[model samples]
Target chain A: MIGFNTVEKLKGIVVVVGNYGSGKTEVSINLAVNRKRAGIDVRIADLDLVNPYFRTREARKPLAKLGIEVVMPAEKYLKADLPILSPVVAGLIRRPSQLTLIDAGGNDVGATVLASLADAFRKTSVQMLQVVNPYRPFTETIEGCLKMRDEIEKTSKMTIIGIIGNANMIDETAIEDIYKGYDFVKALSDESRLPLKFITAPATLLAEIDTGRFSCPVLPIERQLVPPWIKAAGLKK
Target chain B: MGKILMKGNEAIGEAAIRAGCLNYFAYPITPQSEVAEYLSRRMPEVGGVFLQGESEVAVGYMLFGAAGCGARVFTTSSSPGISLMSEAISYISAAELPAVFVNIVRGGPGLGGILPSQADYFQATKGGGHGDYRLLVLAPAGVQEAVDMVMMAFPLAEKYRNPVMILGDGLIGQMMEPVEFSDRFKSEPSNKDDWATNGMATRNRKERNLVKSLFLDAELLEEHNLVLKAKYDRMKQEEVRYEPYNIETDYRALIVSYGTMSRVCKTAIDNMKAEGVEVAMIRPQTLFPFPIKAIRAAAAKDGCQVVISVELSMGQMVEDVDRSVQGKCPVHWHGKAGGEIPTPEEVVDVVKSFIK
Candidate 1:
């Protein structure tokens, strides 16, 4: 059994973060799709200020077409050098929807934006989580996870509600890899006191794993973010 | 194409658009404000959003909402603003979303001053959030790199589903330099509807989607964190990027730096070359997924006996270097943080001291 669909709906700021190639965007896209499929009004915001390529906001038009409220930086500021935060989000945080997801930049440096929203969080109970990829840097061990958690919380001024264990070996991820990742995140949860929200596996491997064992939930991730290779194919649609 | 002079902030804006990213979110801060000034007008032309956030905090949260819906979102800030954004960065990690962040760094520790400083090294490269995360960090030496990196950042951010940072200092952001555009670089369609929560019609087809970072139970969270660990590991192997200059020489010391600081080191290298100092420099283009292998290999070299970590800060990255060397060679620290950039002559002096 693996981390399966024990959880369908939850509340507060659901965040997604990881190393540069762990498919965090696909997970974000899938989670947005899956939960919305389950009937929850969702508003997703992209917070990454780290890298420019392959950001979730690139999918804004499609997300908007899906009728999902895609909160993002102003296109005018899209290419700005100096970061200019918008006040519109503060109003949203004060009164959250059924589901509000915050997609952040990678690492503590990029994740530090949480501090700016401290006032918004103080106004409401915001549940924060760290998306972990076992294969990424500083995440190979429980200690590394701890360090990462501390930095995020200390910087963001928000407590982490749990962990999202999404482990993959790039496009080569196997079902076994998902299982190993489940155990690893579980271990971190036990040591850190945060709960394990879910385990993610690509749609390709979703069928291979036993869905019964998980105490939390299982997310069937669909990768919409295209690598250069797949962009030209029919996937470009 | 021909090169044209541009500020680091303006370059970032144009480059991000050219990179195929349409959504931009951020808070205003000093020195880097040009980015906001430049983008506010451009967003409307392309049918994009450009909002002036309440604070760095809110902008970060806005980015989170946007990124979760599957969009290319970003923010830019100086030291103080970045400090305010630390909390949301952690949430972004928890959700495992992909986005780009730019830090036009200024001096700090309590808004020390608004000049250039690489002091945030520890915070930036080592995951500035609250969890076991490592953002792919890229330091651009010039305007072209600053712009080019934003183009690369989108795909890289999407490919790994992780945040990638374009890090530089005030000098870089304010300075003007010629840049050449990327070839065959514009985006089309912007087909993002697959998952974004735009309105009711989409949610009607399936269960309403919720983007949250909460887990009530202990066991579930543990299981979740492990998966992130695997992702970080993979990045270490695949995403670590750096630039090695004069590395082929038989040397006694290797100076490691990034962003504006590396340029200073370059000037020193030139002086040392004339003075017959065989010192090499290694600059990490990606600071988060640091070029550890290069550092390790440099430490493993025969004649490369000592490593001197230099930056605009109090040698924070030097600690990582020391960690990388693992005592193979004595990793020394030489830096001046809080807006004090060591001059090229000063860097040369540091090099001279280690000449023996």
Candidate 2:
């Protein structure tokens, strides 16, 4: 059985950062949904000015149904490529909910948006987690993960306190991939001296894999950042 | 290496490298700037050249210069940026240089929204530039196919010594999927010494090669057009590729679609199947050759009553579908143009309209 108590650590001002295509947005959305499902008041700020697509705003309608507030840019500048941060993000940081999650963009360049909000973040006790998908390009190795951590820390001007393992090959993820990912992040946590808060597996695969093997909690991921066609087919993963 | 999750834009960049294309020149555009951003770092690591031109105009010429000297090169841009490159595209086509162009198309006529759209169907399949030249256009429905098509595009471009285009919508540029890079599509660099403008000393030839598209004489221009036309005709006979879905069933409606929109139609067809309404689809992998015979055959199926061109454009590809049907059945158009994609339910509803 997996311990659900470890998820309690994801409260107050929690920020998510990672390399490009490392599944940061997926982890952030699942985190918000996880906390919200647990009956905790969750509000997430979409600080992803770097990427134009697959951001938190795309899930606004569904998130609203779950009563989890999704903060994003204004309607006028919603699709524009410019970096126009909304004041509500600062407002969310100043007065956080039970769990305030900030979904930062991908990479150090994406994380640069966080540096601009340093004043808002400094006022609060923030807990940043770097989601590492070892299957991704940059964070595939321990050295690459360390380099990304340093670059993200330098650009965001915030220190990461924990790691979130999100290794998978999308729809092709297998049982071995989960084990490989867990081992990779476990080693990453040890080398970096950061806590391995949790690792994620597709919700469908949770029944097949033994959750007790993980040293940390296993967050069952229900994928939300998928193309519309996948959603239409009702394929859950 | 095992399959890794990658966005379409980055995968396209890596696919070029795997295809042995060492030169990449591009301008920043929405939905596709990641290609340049990815290649900017990856190119130097691989000891290749990645240049960000002053504009798409300059970038187009950069591709021309690189391809003229027998270098494998490519560029990625959106609709408006592609318009800026059309003139150079014409020159390259007329010059018969081998190069690749990927248009991760967005909504357009002017500066349209940055969301996915197939509105550039006419711009791509037909001549976008002012000339009698045609580009061999390939459209991919998913990220894996996008990578495969990009890898295959270089060889196809070189095979005919002409520019080849991979016509993808914005979703294909932005979406993430697991892609495995394999050696199945790899090809050796073609011998361009016969005609390339590479220095004569490199090939050690006595006669110098001149690369130019200009042919001032009327008869010479006509001859050049016929030669280009012959290559295009060969592509029609040799390069037509498409996937037929649910054709086994006596489908009442045949849907013709391509790129990201076809995936949506697939879902709609599957959904319709559950309700006992059989609808078939013909998804064109190559947009220019267009699988006209396949579409014509699919539309002429025994139970097929109507053919619909379901697209993200405002009835752009519908014209081609109409042309393919050629009065065999009642051809219809269904789509949305304001960057709003038609949902499976919406598609089901649209398909049902033509049913009973």
Candidate 3:
């Protein structure tokens, strides 16, 4: 039945922002595609100004055929040092699709650029979400999250709508790691009141969880942001 | 079974399987590394594809490849690593595909520090990647909500043919809470294999669909944009999600917030009410599909004196508050962005100031 998120008619935009390694870009890609499968019109933009590594425009070839529109700085104007501000993005704000995702760069410095779109934000509805990871150095404590939230908001003149507890350990992670992180984030969520969004998981731990107790939604995490290791290991795909 | 403690990250992974998502991919990142670790061991048991990509960039594209095959794929990463995935995310949006992504967010501004921060709010809600598009943003306040969203995300993605996000910070990802997946999942058919590059079908002659984001010409781009716009227009008429807390209260103010931040506001509202300060909160469950109309009603109600926009960041959702108020009443803001959450007492103080 359409009651399932994959078929339900859910509309609106979702932005994925965080510090450099907070995984904003990865979140942006998956969220954009997933929404489309749910029967919603999804649009996306690559607004990162911090690095020159993998970016959305790089995947233009495949995304184009899917029929979803991608908005980015012109190829001719693309540069590592270019100030990412442009009038083109304003048009997107003016005419957002059922779901529009913005994957911003990391840090207060990166998110500060939202001030550039102050005009667009002033004209329409917007919700900014802060992604938090407990395993990261500075973000290990609740106080750390508060500090970062202040820095980003002050820089952009935008308020964070909520907090997303995305704590995780890479390949070496243990089930206990998730349990530990979940407890910490739950405390922060209780204290802050911002909804803790998705609790991301890899496929390995599905058997260990008795999922009936969680109150929020869950999102399956795919590692599409980073390149494949098999290919790097001299293996062919 | 009532409230078994579990990690948010693990719960998310398990919940997805329970929700019927069989494909998983990701790269290792700080704080969220367990997501990859967990999937590597479990995907095989469930007959799901679980591959740990070399870099965050590669993992993102792999999701693209899998999505191209019409599989319910997903990935996760953190701060600096997520920076590497923007390229593929933009492509995913452009393709209007179905998949799920998770960011166990960490703190940073060019690797400034590893910690929690609401800094990514603008990026998540405002189209973080390059495109004129939006992803349905689901902000779960706790582990339970996180589990519910996973079950919901796949169907939502398939129904809309777009990506969906469960924007969680480190706090949520790391936290422990009890969850029940058996009650969370209800199997449904997936359309991925039909066109998702399922080896070749000898019985049929359907074109081998290619999923791409390329629009080399202006006309084609324009057509795609128009089609997307129409879809969005339809969405406007169909989607609006929220939970009104204490809305039945009269007089005073409307406290607006989402995610776990609103919980702070709720405490403040409750505490302040002890001093006879009346306040209502309008919390949105889906950050992207914000409950705008709800705010308007709260504002136009008989005794509401003010609308307060509360959050982890300075005030990203403040603009929405202004829009809902329509200039009738001033919107107030109370937030702690860099990981600080205003105490109930502080929130009460803020709310009391709005008392008529």
Candidate 4:
């Protein structure tokens, strides 16, 4: 039943990586919050430098208020395109506590940066999750998702222990979409030989969804990291 | 149709496809790469062609080759990539081929930065490549406008037999907004049988059609120049488009802006109006056949004391503003280049200084 309780299984040094636009940031944020609410000491590192938009660091204020420490590069280099990995990311891996979540940059090019810190995870228990969103072009099919998983593992020098299904179209997602997405990810999990840790749905739609339909746990996503325009009107929290 | 939220880059791609443009070729560039990434999947579903060219230079000619065959085609790139495509753009322009190119402008003279900047105004409008030619540049201020302009670019290009550009910025390319596409615009491309290079055998015609910009003789070259100039002049007369804001009564200042920068200015104007300050604006939708007449008219308003050019660059478009004002009133500029966007509050503070 560990698959039905995904966040409960989140132990030391959890890293999330995925193709671009795969909603890894959203999963990272929700996972951190979920662990913290469960009375676990949580620290998340924003290792996303490939995308200037949609990053986990944008939720620093709210996460900090919830007693979750968000580690990131110095303030000046926050928006720079170059990858500036803080020493704290490796330091956390070496002496990880209850839960240390790393929100990695998107794509193989981004996962290449994770290779430098692979040694820290050698001595610790690590679970690298490849967030799969079938809505995105790169992970639309079973073959595409497998290709991405192979590429991420090769570049990061780490193996993906599980898969997270995060499929949604902003404001257009429906109850049927969540089920369809879950089925797609279930097929992906079967073919890729990875456990389905959990699947995500928007918090608004969580009440109507029949969780029995999915074999894995369902995590409710709070919409965050929106564009300047959407943030003006859509802060679901 | 109901509206759906979409990123500016992807929306432009969808709009281009909706406009009956079935061929897309481009190399990936930051801030605008989503356009290519989205089309790479959507194109095949629509039975269209989507290609990632070896380089931006190759992408340009691929667009030319496809456009020469009378295929509705387009490419999207950032500022530095646009510079690489300038030569082909000039060739496409002089050859009078109908193609659509979107430049999600970023800061630059040379790889300046990847953030949004309107530094390519002169290059897009006057001519980036060698030759006396102009691209019909269209600027969109938001995601919905970007979608509309891209859908409009195809027909306008074919109508004039010239290359059309949708000039945007990083902000416009990266942001998201709700948009609804009309079923009306989604149809087959118009006939290009006469000038298209579909092959002499296919057309079953005796005469051979040439698609080239070369003219060896001086006299013939002059004639070609004259013909091209005459077309541009007609465009100026027929295709000048702009939007005027808050010009009903005389105002203290007139802000001339375009594209994403104009949206920031609009926000600033609204904030200032709440504080009892009256400011008018003239947003030019077309940059090449600039709405000089509209800017002049706005500046000529009785109580309009200063004409301010708000832009993302240090002041590229201000020159046009100054020229349009023609020494009638004082002209000024406020901008930030190198990927630093001015906030609405910062813009309002500048407006306060101008009023004082």
Candidates' DockQ values? 0.01, 0.78, 0.02, 0.19
Native interface contact recovery, all models: 0.00, 0.76, 0.00, 0.07
Best by TM-score: 2
lDDT by residue for model 3 over B53-88, one digit each (tens)? 888889889988888776678887776676787778
Provide TM-scores for the models.
0.58, 0.97, 0.58, 0.81
* Error of model 1, residue B143, in angstroms: 1.0
Residue pairs that clash (backbone atoms under 3 angstroms), model 2: none
Candidate 1 local Cα displacement, residue A235, angstroms = 61
lDDT of 2 at B189: 52
In candidate 3 the C-alpha lDDT for residue A194 amounts to 71
Model 2 residue A183 CA deviation (Å) reads 0.8
User: Worst ten-residue run, lDDT, model 3 chain B?
Assistant: B1-10
Candidate 3: stretches off by over 4 Å: A1-237, B1-3, B183-189, B193-195, B199-205
Off by over 4 Å in 1: A1-237, B183-195, B198-209
What's the residue-level lDDT of B178 in candidate 4?
60
lDDT of 4 by residue, A1-60 (tens): 123344566788889999876888888888888777767888999998787766787788
TM-score of chain A of each: 0.88, 0.95, 0.84, 0.94
Better of 1 and 4 by lDDT: 4
TM-score of 2: 0.97
